[model samples]
Target: MKRVVVGLSGGVDSSVAAYLLQEQGYEVIGLFMKNWHDDSVTISNECPWLEDSNDALLVAEKLGIPFQTVDLSEQYKERIVDYMFNEYEKGRTPNPDVLCNREIKFDVFMKIALSLGADYVATGHYCRKGILEKDGEEVYQLLAGVDGNKDQSYFLCQLSQEQLAKSLFPIGELTKPQVREIAARMELVTAEKKDSQGLCFIGKVRLPEFLQQQLQPKEGLIFEVDADSPVYHQEQPTFASQEEELAYLSKNIAYTPELGKVVGKHQGAHYFTIGQRKGLNVGGTKEPLFIIATDVTSNTIYTGQGNNHPGLFKKALFIQQPEVHWIREDLKLKAGEKMEVMARIRYRQPLQKATLFQFEDGMYVLFEEPQSAITEGQFVSWHIGEELVGSGVIS
Candidate 1:
């Protein structure tokens, strides 16, 4: 029997995953990942690591599988926590969940499992894997889960072909409700447990408080730019090439203190993100204000009056060549090539129609319609049908 290592995450999905793999006659071992230990910033009663680890152990015992816990806190801090601090410091938002799956789970944890003679590492992610034959070679495809509402293909967007080859997602074929039912029938400890929130391994945290631990608060001014500002009324320029036109469209609008009036003060510019609406503490506006831009260097945050503000929408976005990642290397676009694909800037966002243009320097994704708050340091994933072909960090 082939030996498989399952990352039992102390949740119904993972519990069911382990049980299903056992039913398939594979020799399964359960390993709960202890990636976070600092609970100072984590909220109370919010999927604490100790509770989660215990639940994972119970599930493994009930499944009659050998189980253990892997302490990956150090690796998680280096690969994920440090990166997040650096990104936020530079006024960019980073997705820790995506980084966690790529840097820790698939890379570090997979190596540990392989060292133990395991044939594959499995998780409870709501995404499917498919195999295709091309030129007598086996190709792995990262397909969306069968459950539309719970599809999590976006989180695994950075996974490489090699990682996908050794990975298994057992619960991808079932909906959330179906998985819950199966766990209930099996009388699993996590059967009625609520899903974990906030960070991947870290529980729900008071974000501002957490960031404050390292990123000390500095008072910053919040300026509210009007919807009819002259900044948004710039005349379109004729471009000599398509790349030139795209470069203009993809660029972020530079905000200045002179462009708007001071509305309020924020604890820190680094704590705010584009499209964020809460924590402003500024009231009495006709419509709620949303963050449109943040300049950490100047410690200034620019806000717009409403969601449909012009500053919030962009027609295109650029990705530096080094940041581009292709799961299906065979389908990668060459310089000067372009392809029509469905793409999303953030997780669970409805796929939007976009065209990817590859250049000598980088790639540009031009959407058919304007998209809101295309933040930097976030991943943009493109899909060809159900298969996620490529992803890149937004520039």
Candidate 2:
């Protein structure tokens, strides 16, 4: 019998996944990865890890499968937690789920499963994998789940070809409702458990609250820009030239339109991010203000009318790491190479059409029709049809 280790998170999806694999005649082992603790930081009420693990154990018992819990708290902190803190410190949003899927589930957990003589390590992820003959060699292809609404290919993009080969996603073909029904049929303990949301480990805690516990919130100035100010006439340069312009434009950018006066200061430029619409205390404008630029060195924040040019919402994004899975042979791509592929900048964002280009210095560029908020330190995943090729962090 083929031994399969199922990553049981004490959720309905995972419980059903174990049931499905066992029904398919694979010898299933329920492996609960203890990734986080309740004592160190505040955890979401929904994700009671202890209760979840116990529930997973009950499900395993019901199915007559062996169950074990692996304490991966240290590995989770080093790989996921530290990475998240570092990204936020750099003023860029990082996807912890992506890192968790890559470093923890595939890398660490897979190793443990393999050591236990398991033929495959399975998860409740809403993704699929297939084998393809590329360049006379068998290659693993990562596919989006059949249920588009629950597809999690974005988070699984960083998975390596070897990892994909051994990973099984039993719930890939089933919709959320179907998975719930399967759990109900099995009479699993987690049949009615709600899905876990928010950060991968921390759960639904607000970003500010989580950050405050890990990082000191430095009081910074918040700059308010006037609508009629000359700064609006200034051309916003690309991210590369932002530093120089921010230094020159900081003082001149904040002109109050209603009072015809400047008001409020902001913290450093590196402190803010793009697409931020809240936390700016510059009062006076009836329209909602959006942060367009940040001058980290000068400690200034530039605001613009919420409804500016649609061009500001960029469609094209550049990526660095490109992992082509379904393609059999290595593709030699160059700059300006436009291929119709689906790309995603964040986990929650939907996949959109884009062209990929191999730029100089290991950097890859993704060109979408309209520009996107291609923030630095964010992961951009690529897909061809249903197969996930690879992903890289936006520079």
TM-score of each: 0.99, 0.84
In model 2, where do residues sit more than 4 Å from their true spots? 38-40, 225-272, 278-284, 295-299, 307-312, 320-329, 332-338, 364-366
Query: What lDDT tens digits, residue by residue, belong to model 2 across residues 1-395?
Result: 99999998888988999899998999999999998775445544657677778988999999999999999999998888888877776666787888888899999999999999999999999988888787698887788899999998788877777788899999999999999988888788888888987666455655665666666655555545555556446676655542233223222223333423345555344546766777666777777767655544445555665556221354344443343222222444554344567877776687777766554444344354544355667777777788777677775
lDDT value for model 1: 0.96
Worst 10 residues of 1 by lDDT: 36-45
State the lDDT of candidate 1 residue by residue for 172-239, as single tens digits.
99999999999999999999999999999899989999899899999989999999999999999999
Query: Top TM-score: which candidate number?
Result: 1
